[model samples]
Target: MAQHHKKIYPDVEIAMPTRPRASLGLENGDPSPIRWCHQASPSLSLIPSPSQTPIQTLNLNPRRCCCKCLCWTVGLLTLLLFIVGATAGIIYLVFQPKPLNFDMTLSARFNVRITTDNPNKKIGIYYEKGSRLSVWYKDTNLCQGTIPKFYQGRQNKTVLNVALTGRNRYGTTLLNALQEQQQTGRVPLDLNKNVPVSVKLGALKLRKVRILGTCMLIADSLTTNSLISIKASSCHFGLKL
Candidate 1:
């Protein structure tokens, strides 16, 4: 009965669960944990940044540039010369001289005698009429007439006559007619001796004449002395004997 009374006076104590200790934010020898210190600045982020590449420049050679320039200059000069030539030709056509007026005609004849001993020789006459007269004569072997006995032992003589008729420009024909009269016993001519004789009528002074041989004769006897009037645009007379 005494033991029961003592036990009842003393109360029994109860046990409770305890929490784990914090690591003071430290790992190994470092004060801050490796994972906590922002991963050590993310290990300096070894990722490479976008790199800028250098741009290459293009360069022009001086020799090539000069050659191109030279080519252009030559082309321009050629064009200029062509333009000048065309301009000059046009100016020449705009101005030209006028022509003269006159009438024109051409004629020719031959005279000869032959003997037996002095065989009759043939005569060839070549003549053309224009602003001028071109005449060529040559002794030929062919003869039409029989030789005369009186000139048998003597040298044969022959004569040729040519006549040009046209209106007088200034009496220039007078001199030629006189000379013809003396040389060939011909009458005075009314033709323009100074004027060039042309193949086409009325195309005088502008006519040209060329003769290869000296068988040309102007017979004053066959020419007219009277002055004649004629209408024409121009007149030319030329003599090649």
Candidate 2:
């Protein structure tokens, strides 16, 4: 009976989908609002809000200032040392000082030929008073004398004659030794000179300084009655501060 239905048909009503009334700008008196929503894919519907990561900051420690200060201090000290060394070198090169040399020869009996030399090329010597020279024979001072005060110019050599007279207490002892050594042609004698002098610069005069020089002589003969000649000689001198 269901397959062979009659020709009578039943009537049915269906409603279509509508958009929201608020989207169409409709008033409350209009027809009822119908909301229509699109079907969303479950994999792509949700979206997260925009956000930013916090920025990192840096702070300086106190030790950084100490390191910087130390570096600057070392640099300044090095610069000062260089300057002082350069100044001292300059001063040394500008001034040239030298020592004096005394050379003597036996030209007469008791009259001695004395030669004094100023070795300094840029400085002159002003020989002051209280300067003396002596001759010795066998630990006995044979004769002693004084040199006149004079001004010795730069790089100069002067020759003078001096007479020495003294009482010989050990006359026989000296004569016996002279006779014994004269035959062997090896005689020893000592000469010492003490000089006080001042150096003269361009226009300035320096303080007085004592120079003690000694000469050891080996002679062929040295007799009280006869003259002697130098065979070998050695000299040494020093400056007293």
Candidate 3:
């Protein structure tokens, strides 16, 4: 019996227990790519690739964004224009600049004279070149002259003198009328003026405009050497744009 126990068998291989494959839904015992896919739970979500995303979600929506920006820009410009218009209207209403007031009279010697003493404290006048003065009796033109360009200050008086040196073809008739009027103590004369003048408000000078004036005067006599009295005088004023 001692001899039998001492005897040993040749080296033998042993087998180990394997994990269950049914949990992974694998028909074969070896691991595979399909086996890994089946190993995940059905509730797990799949991540989408960059190219597979929806076009609507990925796009920047340029049309809507540009429309919003354009609308805002237009609104701002409209508001600015409106504000400017309102401001200009207010300024025009507040500062209404007007032409100078003129008073004219005819002398006994058929001379035309004009005087301006600015009645307004805030407005001034600048007389430009090409100003004209004329004297008329009915349809007859008696004298014509030009006024020297000058600036007239506010509340300051300016005087212009013009002589009737021109003689018309009907001078004898005019002379007779003048003599008759002088003896009758009443002379009817018309004074007309065309003046280019710029208006001023405080220190700002406006665009140049044309002033037209007409005056009807009655004097006592036409004597050049004697003192004369103007009995009645009326004037009308207009401006050309």
Q: Report the poorest 10 consecutive residues by lDDT, candidate 2.
A: 101-110
How do the residues 56-143 of candidate 3 rate in per-residue lDDT, one tens digit apiece? 7667799999999999999999999999999989988999877896544333244556677888789999999988888787788877
lDDT of candidate 1 over 173-235, digit per residue (tens): 444544454564433222222222223222222344552222233333333444222222233
Q: Give candidate 2's error at residue 1 in angstroms.
A: 99
- What is the lDDT ranking, best to worst? 3, 2, 1
**Model 2 per-residue lDDT tens digits across residues 5-59:** 8677766665555765466535665666666678886886555455544555778
Per-prediction TM-score, please? 0.19, 0.51, 0.50
**How does model 3 score by TM-score?**
0.50
Clashes in model 3: which pairs?
Answer: none
